[model samples]
Target: MNLQKFSLEQLASFVQGKAVGQTEMQLDGLASLTQADAHKLAFVNADKYLDQANQSKAGALIVTEELRAHITSQQNFIVVENPYLAFAILTHVFEKKHTAQGIEATAQIHASAIISDTAYIGHYAVIGEHCVVGDETVIQSHCHIDDGVEIGKQCFIDSHVVLTGHCKLGNRVRIHANTVIGGEGFGFAPYKGKWHRIAQLGSVLIGNDVRIGSNCSIDRGALDDTIIEDGVILDNLVQIAHNVKVGANTAMAAKCGVAGSTTIGKNCIFAGAVGVVGHINIADNVTVTGMSMVTKSISEAGSYSSGTPMLESLHWKRAAVRFKQLADAPLTQMLKRLDHMQAQIESLESTFKLRK
Candidate 1:
């Protein structure tokens, strides 16, 4: 898709920034400072990148007002409060142009399935019996839509995704490639020296504008529904267990695992590799730092963190030894101090009574 280059003035207006250089300079797209050409725009957000910005071949640059003095090139510059955020907006504008349109005939759609003519189904896709795909939805190659699955309008399902039976996805839901939805929960019972499988009869219900990253797995509930509420963004390799409810607008980073029956509240952020235990409730607007182990419920909305950072082997061993002795050391010292204080108080009282 070939699009017209935007003038510096137009870009500044689009990004709500102030023009610092020639407004008539044109920029076709955005690129990194080191690789940007004369037709592209680049941004400098870090002090370390200021040198690269000066030497960049781009015709235009987006930068904060504080970095203006460091610029050596006579190219067009747009000054914004946050250069990174401005670049994010511009990148999204150009990304929309490269998207494909309309469904392919090679898609294997069932006769009983209902798909909107406006929806785009890519090559080698399988839409199972009685499935309903809504308008303007795009299902890419090698995707499997099982029986009775319902996907709402304007959804984007990437390649190799599996939507198991009875899964329901709401409008504008974006699922990345190789993600599995509505898989059976890990539930089993031990009976007479044999393991008996507990059937996972419930489905997964995903709400509108939820973005699930690549290779993520969401398990279906054991007896109740596994619910992902509206506007949730899950990063790659995240594992969401059965009967878990992720509240609206919560964003979880990569490798985070939420165990079964945990209810995560709205607008919460979990950093990479955070592990939350089962059957706990996390309050709204909670922020969990990277690699934290959440073992209990959090009733207040605040930042919580656990787990020690990596240290040198020798130092770590010493610290571990000290940690083990901490419990006994504190109690022993408290008892000795209490005995001395009681003896001193009794002696002072006896002396005062004799003097009186």
Candidate 2:
């Protein structure tokens, strides 16, 4: 029997789903409905994509209850509560597992540091004094784990990543290459016509299953710890400023910046290059679109966007001119124009009354 090929019955049992058609048909891999082959499985999540799913050439389809009516008799399918989530589970099952074991001889480890026997410390990696590295954790090459840091089990710290100043990370945390945690925040005070730097006295607290991408900077707080709650995913070049409390399961895309002291609630999604101002509270389940500038606190859960949409140069120039004129237009002149129009209407009404 082929290791990759599984019967539709076995697939449904694996995903804990209900089979709609012939369960004896075999499947090899997963693919998009538009590109799926006879051996692959395709999934439909939205109502708009139901027609495409029904017309797909895949041997098997995974769909929600809303899409069951659209499927034709020729299709072999599985009905699940959430097709997209079920597909996500399948991706994990198909993922290649890499297990790294044993510390490299080239690593610079302090005698006072505590490292698990099962952990893998890569070449040129630095483990500072009093630091704790948990079991099965892989610290990749050139990583710097500073003094008093605590990293839990099964965590993956990628190459050149820096965890400074007693930072803490829970189990299964993943930090990609060149990401810096516990760097000093941008805090300054005016003193004698010069700026005085405020000491960054706190570290970063990253909860379980948090994955931070490459080149991202999470600054150390001025006083309290900069906390990233469980399941927070930060994309590449993302800037999470000091004293920020990112609630659980919030995902931020590439180049998104959250200013200092902001409290972002759970399940919030920030698209690429979105900016959130300091001292603001963003409610749960809020989604900010790409390149949006959030200048204030959001009190409700909804999609929020800012910045003007892209327009043609000529049309934008004309609109810009009109926008500038609106500010220059006098209130008295607007009231006068309204009064004159009302007078004209009244005169027209009198003329109609005379004609009648």
Best by lDDT: 1
Q: Estimate each model's TM-score.
A: 0.85, 0.84
Over the stretch 135-214, how does candidate 2's per-residue lDDT look in tens digits? 99999999999999999999999999999968999999999999999988999999899999899998899999999999
TM-score of 1: 0.85
Backbone clashes in model 1, listed as residue pairs: none
334 in model 2: Cα distance from truth in Å? Answer: 5.2
Clashing pairs in 2: none
Tens digits of per-residue lDDT, candidate 1, 18-62, equal 886778877788999999998888999989999899899988889
Among the numbered candidates, top TM-score falls to 1
